[model samples]
Target chain A: MDNNKLQAKDFITIGIFTALLFVVEFACGILGFIHPYIVASYVIMIPIVGSVPMMLFYTKIEKFGMLSIMSVLLAIIMFVTGMGYLGAPLIIGAGVIADLIAKSGGYKSFKKTVLSHGVFCLWICANYFPVIVTADSYRKNLVDGGYSTEYCDNLFRAINSKTIAVLLILCFVFGVIGAFIGKAVVKKHFEKAGIV
Target chain B: MALKLDPRTKLFMIFIVSAVVMMSATTPLLWAVRITMTMIPIFLLIAEKHYAAALRFIVLYSAALLISFKFLSENSKGFLSAFLVGYCSIIVQFMPAVITAWYVVRTTKIGEFVSAMQKMHVPDGITISLAVVMRFFPTIKEEYSSIRDAMKMRGIMFGGGNVTDVVEYRMIPLLFSCVNIGDELSAAAVTRGLGGKVKRTSVQELKMGGADYMLILMFTAALVFFVVFKYMK
Candidate 1:
């Protein structure tokens, strides 16, 4: 709990939380593979599932830089797994700002945690940025490789249609939703765990 | 040969190569480099005597490429094929990182990794958090299996399972126990003198050597060549 020292348990809490985030992500991946039709569902579930562990993490660490450390670690993992290097910067930046907001509420403000989580959720969409930006090149690669014109155009258009702004707003709405749900779950079930 | 390189260098190179693969518009030369970069992992896995895993990577990568090619060339249109194509491309793009991660994780010892981070002057927050990342997953795996067993005994099958049933019965309890684990682990770490004010030392030898420098130089040259080719062409 001490910001200055950050005993081993604090780091342990951060580590487990990071792994939990990844586990939820892995669960989401399994769902996507099984129900490819529900890829869109992932956009919502990604934040909510991730935030479940994160809300508990925030509740326990209750200090500065814990979220930042966890975010950086998760970002590194995401990058290493080929999600995108873009996630690294986006996560670290969003994490720091989120940490600041949480700090403003003295790390106990549930409202601040919710707002911070909403901001933090934006980074999860970093995986899409490369697809959106390179949609044209991907189209070109397909077309030049003897793909049909319609298929190429349709694929490119599909990716291009979802601009960055649209993605962020979606994350914001869902992030708030996810955070509130996590808060309720934590309060109800994890109460005896003492995090709440 | 890359096995001799420092853990820090492997991590740095992976990040650099992954970013390049993600960002490029795919000129001919870049494609050549991407193919070669993808193969490095396979070779390293082979060197590490992981023959089965290495063969598996080759088969998967080839399969993905074939699938993408087929989808791209298809005249009939639907979101399903398009989605498959998109996903295939993503898999191919991320393959190098995935392979490299596999190699690093399989080859590097935990003590060596911690020492490597210490040598890099990484903050305790990050280093200790990473140590935790290292320990957490295997623990989770054990706990996960037991939870599944418990669910089976209780007749808690999913598919027809209710959402609240999962949230109430499965996730909450799993999270609750994980929290307890975290507390015990942290206490164990503290008693072992982790998070001390003074500098900590480890028995792991993690210094950069000649191979590390050579690999760094080689990657740096390749990067320079890519940049020059990108602009000059």
Candidate 2:
């Protein structure tokens, strides 16, 4: 029974950090859209791009359920705004796992922080899963929503193809690389500013 | 008198619409919904006296809706088709929902919303964070513009500069300030005793008036009809 009660300050901290998540995520979204050609691949790089800010945030707010609530809110907004549906349920599991990892080192250990974030990055893959795996339902929703089946089929066929396995594997590989980079960036920048 | 639907009512409308959009409820219903959803933003903007903006939004939404309908009905092939079907179509689908959300965010004061949530027995944790999020986004927009201006003075062009350099210069400083401001906000919130265990009260009256109830009733009936209709068909 983890009975740690959050205070007003904690809520404020949560608010700020949640907003920060949106801020960084929104910034990255802009970059992804700018190139147009790399947008698909850029979507894959989001967890890596987003992990930099998450590093500082995780260190600053190490309490349980902090990341969980953040993930849930972000995922819900994403789903509602037509971003991804699978992210919400998938995030709850990832949030708990990340929380456990952070708890192991009392959140102060850099190695634990890096590892926690590495696992946390897995939530980024949730949005892509339905597109890649349960693609029929994905197509069904669009068609149901007034899009033509022909369009949905043509559009998603490449993603629904076998390259999906490669995409999933690359997600983990990027997670490892991204978390290490996040760990480094936190030390290099945030620590000096005492923001972390 | 101009319509003064309670913030909660507005939320309920948005919520049901979102659910309909999410479920992809039924095709005939969805055709009606697409038009109805587009009207929400128009009505909201007009209600707020944003005449020009309302006109612009309706024009763009209608145009995108038409473009999507045209392309989608065709058996599109290759990247152009893929992009239109995959990307543009999604945008077209989400436009009304996005615009409705934007309207709600723009029109509703956070104080009223929190009070409404309180009346609805929302946990303080959720309400507090929601309040904070409501406050923080506009600040970020302000911060973003200031950073852009500062970068402009320093010869860091967003459009022309090296992409990585632009990101580093732009994002790092934004994150830095965000952290600093976050700390400051926490400190301020603490001073105000925002995290206290007692029930927080608000001056705003969250009245579920007759009109509100009527609207909710109608919405529920329509939703039920659609779901049943989908099953029957």
Candidate 3:
């Protein structure tokens, strides 16, 4: 394919992905399965999944410039769309780190992709830590305000312990699954699409 | 029609509202003002035809409020106050960002936005990764829907069974699928020369126009006013 045509195709793909992410996030939020920490995790994971097709496109088409373009766009959307201003910067940082890891692993290998996602997962843990700490403090404030100390204490414990455990499990399972899917799909689609 | 102002302006407005709301705890008046401020963003979202997005915000805020009220207070007095504080803080913090995002996505082409970022000195590899993720989000969603359909076809009723059973068997698998999609996305980014070291120039240049400057100034003024008002108490 011509370089221009390839660039256009990549743009379309990115737009579609962003829209999908918005829909999934909205659905999860409405279903009550999404909390602050989950939102953080989900946003961080997006680039990890997105990087595969991006790399494929770049490799095949030799249109390396497109990647930076996509990142800025994604960052702006995340920042401006109430994902939190910090989210955009954090994602940008995570993307940079993931990219470096990918490069260090010789970008062409599956190991690079998997490692990048793993790094993203670990980096996003910081986002969740604040919520846990805040919940703890809020609970303490409630106790001081003469709320049932036991109940507040229990809630705090639930959030700090059980909630964290569940989140960790989710991260591990999702990270591994995302890695496997990326490997399979990239090998199947991009290689055949004649883009890689 | 509600927020016709620039996104940068709206962002400033949110910052001012948030500062005022956070400064004085246990104040119904402050909470009400903050709540009313939050309504403006929702109105903007609706005006923009993003009703689903607006509804999502309402649900999230409502849940946060309920939790704060139920857990933070012993009496009705404290409950209402805590709820307002909790809810208003989130709205105040997030609303402007959402409104700004809506404006950007609606106004600028995605490519242009990405180009602007590159011009501003973001690394090439990082930029590419961000783009791919944004790009693949929709594809993943479609994939998820198809998977969900397949599961339904196989008689897997989503959210209709025993809570534990649904969580253990159904929800877990669905979440796992999302992870699988992420993996695919990463591999695609790597093969595309995302981490390559070639200096890149984007077609878009995010210049600070006069309007942007004016909005920033206004934001600064509002922030100052909020600070003064808080300390005066």
Candidate 4:
């Protein structure tokens, strides 16, 4: 593809991808089965899984500039939409970290792509650490307030019990699935279309 | 020259105002002060011929403040003070950041901002990510508008149904699309040379000028005073 045409395609891809991320996050929240924590987990994971397609597009099109632009854009959107006060900083920080990992692994290489997702997973895990602590505090508060042992037990069950464990496992499994999908889609479409 | 304050300066102002607002939540006087402080950037933006952008910021912040306050009030006792504190702190904390970011984007080119990050020893991955985020904002906004339009065409009534239904059914799709977009974009970034190892340079340079230094100092002083005053009680 000529340089101008390639640039236009890259821009369009970036636009589409940004919209896709927002939509997926919204859907996860709407599904009702996933709690806010799970949704937040998805938000953290999506970017990591995203590394695959990013590498594919850049490799084919040779327009590396979009990476930085997209990272900033995601952070701004999260912040403006009132995701959280820390949303912008976290997105920016995570994006940079993920990018560095991708860079170090040699962009588009299998090792680079897998490591990027791993790094993203670790970040998501770390982000939820505070929530775990908060839940523990709430549990203690319930106990101290003379709530029934059953109530306290249920509270713990709600957070650290079977449901949370199952959810976390699901997140990890889905993350892996996303990575694979990213790889397959990029390889099938962009490469075949000769748009890369 | 719009809102020509340095980012560091604005950051300091945010720090001070947030501290004071958080500390004296029930005091109407403090809330008034907080509101006035929040207005500084808005006024500056208006004076600098960026009134429309300033209004957009106001609307966004106000919506966030209202939602949070409503939720807090519904959920907690002694919520009045907490709500006041929460809203005041939000305005104080976020307005300056927004203003500073606007100034950064307007005065300096993206390339220059990247170079500035480089000079400050920010990692290449981070620098690139920051750039991507800046570029992504407008695109996402456009995407949101398009989705909203599509929903309207489909006769997805926004407010005519059960509130829970509207949020669950209508809003979810829009949000899902955003996450999907992020997934695609992240992949695209990796394919590009974003994570490359060469010592990268920018097309423009961000230099710290005297105005920036002065603004930083003033903001720092204000923050310190507010913190000390609040804590002394």
For model 2, the stretches where C-alpha displacement exceeds 4 angstroms are: A1-3, A27-43, A83-86, A129-134, A137-158, A161-169, B24-29, B159-161
Candidate 1: where are CA atoms >4 Å away? A1-5, A29-41, A142-162, A193-196, B1-5, B24-29, B70-83, B167-169, B209-211, B225-231
CA shift at B122, candidate 2, in angstroms? 2.4
* Model 3: residues with Cα > 4 Å off, grouped in runs: A1-90, A132-177, A185-196, B1-4, B7-26, B42-222, B225-233
Best by the DockQ measure:
1
Q: What are the clashing pairs of model 1?
A: none
Comparing 1 with 3 on DockQ, the higher-scoring candidate is 1
Docking class of 4: incorrect
Candidate with the greatest lDDT versus the true structure: 1
Q: In candidate 4 chain A, where is summed lDDT lowest over 10 consecutive residues?
A: A122-131
**What tier of docking accuracy does candidate 2 attain?**
acceptable
lDDT of 1 by residue, A1-196 (tens): 4456666778888888888888887777666643333444555888887777778877875668888887898788887777776557877888888888988998888899899888878777665666565677656666665455655564445445454576678787898888998888788777865656
- Model 1: docking quality category: medium
The 10 consecutive residues of candidate 1 chain A with the worst lDDT sum are: A33-42
Model 4 stretches astray by more than 4 angstroms = A1-119, A125-170, B1-3, B6-37, B60-103, B111-115, B118-129, B139-214, B225-233
Can you give the lDDT of residue A42 in candidate 3? Answer: 54
TM-score per prediction, in order, is 0.86, 0.86, 0.53, 0.52
Which candidate, 3 or 4, would have the higher lDDT against the true structure?
4
Interface CA root-mean-square deviation for model 4: 10.2
